[model samples]
Target: VESISVKKIETVEEFKDLKIQKSEKGRGISLTLPPDIAICEECLKDLRYKNKKKYYMYPFVACAVCGPRYTTVNALPYDRERSTMIEFPLCNEDKTSCVKEYKDFNNRRFHAQTFACAVCGPQYQLYDRSKNIIETNSIKEILEITARRINSGEIAAVKGMGGVHLICLAEDDKVLEELRNRKKERKYKPFAIMTPKLAILENLVIFSEKERELLTSFRRPIVILGKKKGSNDGILSNQVAPGLSSIGVMLPYAGIHYLLFDFIGQKSLIYTSGNVSNLPMGIRNEMIFEQLKGLADFFLLHNRTIFQRCDDSVLRVHNDKVKLIRRSRGYVPEYLPLPFEVEISGALATGPELNVTGAVLRRNRVFPTQHIGHIKSLETFNFLKNALFNIKNLLQIEDKEIEFIACDLHPSFYTTTYAKELAEKYGINYFPIQHHFAHVLGLM
Candidate 1:
């Protein structure tokens, strides 16, 4: 559906691999689900290479093949205006160079949706808990300052494409304990650690080819890796994962994370959601500071508005088969084909409470929203609605077809109530499918 044309060749020997018919043909509008791809080598080189012009210290630098997608996007055609990046317009050099490269098929940035440079893209600003600006002049210096704070055991809230993360040097046991206490997270819940690359983990954990692939893939989910046999694990504080032999580890998926790695050196960082326990991940910097109170010593944030809050996806390979733990980021806003084709078109399915998820059936595909936290609170419920529409608008399924609204049979549930209201308003049939029946059919 995405590709334009096909050509027949006389023979394999006659085929020239790199031939292009350059003409005055129209460029197609790019339609992408835009998962948060791991920053490509080119962008990483630009961050490290001083001669890369405006791309140096540009935390959000990206090309068409990589960078943020679902987190920054609002609605699509996948245009920049539909993304959080719409707020940052291109600078003169970046705009002119982008146009020149975009017109040339040979350029890597040709038709790149998220292409950006330092002068024309979002810049990271470090602020205190009161939101006072600490550093804004240069990313190199900003990261250096943030690194020093972390080394001194000060917690910093680093904002990413998805949401804000409360981060600190993971080597300090006191810092890990403080972060866990501040977040009020479960004692049994392990904190995921973020690092620069995969090479650092070679001595830390046992890695299979599949595990390495998942760790380095564009989705960039935290893969739970088992500890190496009889290997000492005193370097990273035990408070990170407590008694668990395995630890959740991830590589830098966004440009900002990679830049932070440069200054932070080889040390691990406690990267947990920037919100108190039982609440959604904080998006806006002001709201994050309010929620975190004085826990975050410095706020490393940018101007990008997260369309929807997405937690880092977590996966574990059990018996060499991938087991999804927390499904968000990288894997969302994409469709899952049902076992049997869903007959109804544009049907809404309101999932059950806790570990909650929602979906919309458009054509033969079911577009499930990313894990929308528990709908127990008003805030989480609002997040559910926002995520539902975010996926709907992106899928271009605005007019809800008058098919049945599927909800759990339980009465008085928030999700069920919302489904009833939507069904009534749309004059559609509502099915109160039993939660057990749903369990049998795997609908839940």
Candidate 2:
């Protein structure tokens, strides 16, 4: 039996004689899980090395340093089993099979939960809008086809990190008009343009020193930039930014996207969510076929499954400060140390306002899922529920161990209502936190 320690204390009044004793023992090693980091310089060097076994041209060659984080994750405790990696089992050829052990090894793949080789990782496939398979081997071919189609004035539905994107030639007025007409999107909101890189963006838009720095930051968020004076106003349709003085822009973040830019050689391309107006981006093949059949001419798709649907996070530098407009993708999983230590367990926090979700203290680490869009419709609501349940089970948490349930104070929020249902079903204490207060605590 373990021995317990007791300490006596002194106080005033009726409780002066009262004594409190606490037991001290080695609980275990505390684990601190951080949000997935960007691809470190070391890993990038390895990827560029030609002679290395895992070198350049390998699209899936990611290590613990950088890769998918919230997008690929199914649940908390962010283990491989709870991630999209589960779909692609580890290659037996590699001695380090498991993600945990792989991270422990002194290799490039160390700490990379989403790390995998082309042999045992997510793969891509291209298809026409009619669901006919076009190509499968090389993603470059699909990009080539899409680029040609775009140059010829056609909208292409390009699948990306979290969701599908409706891509069209930014410089082609007829193409933009056609897309607008097809979608019937009112010229109220601005569309985000995907540029090859910062270098290309500098040519198109005037970037201040601060703006340049934020645009190239690891988060690589979409930065809204004012149009350059004397620039070709005809390059983009005026409808792209109806009332806004600036345009939203982002650089390519993924290898496939980089390849597309390389093939196109164009400075920028119009990129928007690949879905009908007011609907969430299509996730599944069936959903894509049903929802986006008439909207897109071709579909550049892949076989890898997306556990959660995340939209691109938008940010702007205002009053010399970086303000997050749409928090998703790169800026999620905001890491904050817990105020008090409780049981070594994980919790899934369904964020308030629109549809934001994050996981907390999985192995003492918290990773917020990228911004899931507004959970208004049944389809989006169902996607949110699935994402939550999948993340919970992925962290290997049993139904009973969930001690506390958290939700927003907003009564009309679907997430809040669902959280209440979960609490009732599990007989757990539910804490209704105010949305603004939660945001304040997050900032702290």
Candidate 3:
């Protein structure tokens, strides 16, 4: 391993003397941008602690090591000004002392770009089917009322860090059946359920230590675990996973999720991506409501904009190792290293049409985009295109440096067509890789 010399500065002046050197033209090095981190234990404690006045019950509590990274980022060099959090400016001195916390090195939120308190940060609001806001005294009241509605077997479109989720009761057969019927596209596919705690999930699914670790880890990906023998009898409706022996489960990852659980009576609730009939998941407020019409009885939305539409990541543990099904949300914008240096200076690969994720390779590291569902429709195709553009922008990879574009061999595949278009636009070479061969190459 190549090691660089290290030095410790004893004073502010000593630290101030340090300067960052710019990389050579067309060549640079950086750490892979992190995925959205789950709410830390300290942050969770501050949620209810009386002394933490500004943070008490605050839904947007975040520190440098936690909160959104890829999903909220518009452009990068990764700073507050380049993120969606820019909309929520720091509170006035009278309401909160965030600026002080930002400057205080001893504070957990020191220099946190997404730092904010209830007074100045994003706020949640409940909306009826007619798009009328259901007035509530505070976010707590909103959560309580939302939970009550869900408990009463009503469906709700709950917006989270990345995209909207269609949530409902997991234990009621009638409710599950109705949800399946309403969300016609996913009639028989298993729906992932979110639990407040690990104990509740343990009682329903049989999981290994590895699986448990994944469930509680900072990434908080949905872990598919085998259901215990009587789990489907009553606790969880059989319809939750249809006839499958395994079920996908995830724990509360955000402050809103944790707080909402405080008011929910059930051990778990159905939390699936909010999309209908093969379309992409919803992110924008106006687009979400219209897209999910009649599917959701209410909407538990937030004022914060989602700069990127990311869906919850899904994975499973086999032989004590984690196997990812869909990689998004908590595991994106991160570069995957190749053992050997790449011959090309830079290249972009547009994955197959279904369950696709585009990739941009520079030198030896490949940065994969978040899960960009089916590319059959123009809307979804544009989502993939934008995702590719964002990653390239973040990496500062100029079009001139992209030597080649890769795609599936199928001529009619939308991704293939897009890859050709990109190649033509940038005057780069395009390579059509055989579909199955691409999977084998991934194994390499």
Q: Identify the leading candidate in terms of TM-score.
A: 3
RMSD of each: 4.0, 10.3, 2.9
Q: Give one digit per residue, the lDDT tens place, for model 2 in 1-444.
A: 124799987867574342223223222222222343344555556555666544354455566657667667755555677687888877666554444336454555545567776556766667787899985465456567766777777788877667788887777767777777778764456788988777767766777788887777666678888877533466666666666668898876666666676677765788888877556788776787788888888887767777667677788888878887877766654543566665656555665647566454554556445556677687767766666665555445667667767889998888788778888888877788998898798787
RMSD of 1: 4.0
lDDT of 3 by residue, 1-444 (tens): 135798986765534332334323343644345788898998899888878788888888888788888888776556778789899888758624887777666777767888788877898889998899999997778888988898999999999999999998899988888988998878899999998898888789998777878889999999998999999777899899988999999998998888878888646899999998768888999989998877999999999999889999999887787788999988897778899976666789998989999999888988899999888788998899899888888788888989999999999998998889989999888999999998898898
Question: Each model's C-alpha lDDT?
Answer: 0.78, 0.67, 0.86
TM-scores vs. true structure, each candidate? 0.90, 0.75, 0.94
Leading candidate by lDDT = 3
Better of 1 and 3 by TM-score: 3
- The per-residue C-alpha lDDT of model 3 at residue 163 equals 93
In candidate 2, list every pair of residues with a backbone clash: 33-365, 64-111, 64-112, 74-391, 75-391, 103-111, 333-368, 358-368
Could you tell me the TM-score of candidate 3? 0.94
What lDDT is obtained when candidate 1 is compared to the true structure?
0.78
Kindly indicate the candidate among 2 and 3 with the higher TM-score: 3
Q: In model 2, which regions exceed 4 Å deviation? A: 1-58, 75-82, 89-107, 110-113, 118-120, 136-140, 232-234, 336-369, 387-413, 428-444
- Predicted structure 2: lDDT: 0.67
